[model samples]
Target: MFRRFVAIVAFVALAAALTLVAWPQLLGLQRAPVLALAVSFRGAAAAAALAVAVVLTAVGLVLHRLRRGLGVLALLLVAFAAAEAGVLVVRGVGAPDVPVAQADDVTVLSWNTLGDSVPAQVVARAAAENRATVVALPETTEGRARQVADLLARQGSTYTVFSRSQQAGIPARSTSVLVSTALGRYREVTADGDTVGVPSVVLDPAGGQNAPRIVAVHTTAPYDLDPATWRSDLRWVAARCSERNVLIAGDFNATIDHLDGLGPAPGRLRTCRDAALATGNAAVGTWPTSMPALIGTPIDHVLATPNWRFTGFRVLSDDDAAGSDHRPVLARLRPAG
Candidate 1:
């Protein structure tokens, strides 16, 4: 009787743990260590669940006495897997076709060049091809940005560059932004402070009247094993997004899941909404070109204040061999009025 009681307790504990793993937010443990990592890669988590289910089924076939218990555990895993898949489906999976830019439409492209791994010419061509007026590059130096601007100018596309760096030597500490001359001149204004560790660029139009505030973001990656710094960077970015009429782009080092409670509003960090999510492309990942979009994590993004509406968003994967592990994300927006 004591053995049976212990078994029941163990079963209950296992089910509870799995349930929390599948949905960490249930207990506000989404940001906890193992749970945070698990949610970051839902596809992998789901696959793991199914794999364990298969093993459980094999064990059940050989061990009759424990067969029922194992079978129950296997079913639980399968259910968790299905639930994760259902979430992905609900968030979205397919990429939408990019819309042609209108005269007043603003085309923003965000790409982490992996510390200038991609050539300036390639970056220029990408912007021109997409008719991007604003480009945010994380882990890119001012020198590389100038090269891109010069290349664009030689090709009849004029751009003004703004850049910031936490320190010299480390390319990851730098970030660059390019705003087309067509949109008027913009000046770098993040002199006082920046993200917790990674450098981020803040820009304001020359007149600073009736223009959108722009931020080129590069938050510390969680893999640095510095959760505090990572979370602080996210919070700082969120504060910037609170104001109206803002445009933000770059490597956030976080997924929408990780942004919960960090935002001022539900589904928004401050008032900024993720363009990919608004356009139904949130499920498509943007990092680790080695993995399929469905399996990898979406750490890159473009977000805008409520004043702007997202017409289209997509993660560009054709340049898989482009030297950078990240795939470029493009978001097209127009004033909401």
Candidate 2:
């Protein structure tokens, strides 16, 4: 009886785990708690599924004599978990080859500097190395943004920086956009009277022809501390993406899966990570520098309208060494002709 009870409990637990992994949004748990678990599970879906499968297999082996029916049920659960894991692996396997960027391609880089622990020089060097035309920094201040631009200028690369802070003058948290002089000038786009607390700016092309309306954004992280505000902030950014030719880049604090609610159909933003996943170079994880990238949730992103084609995407390796908890994401794009 004891062995059968243990087997039943294990089977139920495994089933619940698999269900959560399969459809996280369906879970009625609190938004923040479920989202946090989903992040880890989604980042390593195959692994999570496989672990459950292994547990089920062990349970089956142990209960083969005590309850033959329970043993068969456990075996079935193992098969189910294996199938789920296979599906995840198939969807996540990256493309074998991604085309290189051309001179005509526009490159954008986004990174969260973790309260300015990364030096301006490092940021500048990374931008130059990646040939980034636009750079978005979250958790950065106006002064630091200018300092990075200055470093880039010293290296013969000129960029115009636009920054906005939540507070006027207290070294508060901020978001910044750095547009290369080569990409023409840009202006700040403000939210008229709304207070979702996300910072953004827009870049209007020189002749305003064929260039994308570039927007840099940083949404709040979804946690118990402020999940409602975080969701609202994401909705605001999503609404902005509904317009044509808008390309947004920054730390969204939510994944592609979490974006189902931010919709009105047809005008939803697409992530550059999709292209990377297709090309086998997706940054499976982009947070908490301590964990291997495959296990970390990719929160930082470069998103664009359907009119643009993503040629290449990469998450910079220098992020961990620079003391930031997030990795830098860079994407190369070309207008769909």
Q: For every model in order, what is the number of clashing pairs? A: 0, 4
TM-scores of all candidate predictions against the true structure: 0.94, 0.80
- Residue pairs with clashing backbones, model 2: 94-280, 95-278, 95-279, 95-280
Candidate 2 off by > 4 Å: 1-17, 25-36, 44-100, 168-172, 192-198, 203-209, 261-283
Give the worst 10-residue stretch by lDDT in candidate 1: 259-268
Please, what are the lDDT tens digits per residue for candidate 2 over residues 120-237?
8888888888878889998788888899999888889999888877765543267788888777666665543222555655556655556677777787677655478777776677
Task: Give the winner by lDDT.
Answer: 1
Task: Give the number of the best model, judged by TM-score.
Answer: 1
Error of 1 at 118 (Å): 1.5
Show the lowest summed lDDT stretch of 10 residues, model 2.
Answer: 264-273
lDDT of model 2 at residue 119?
Answer: 90
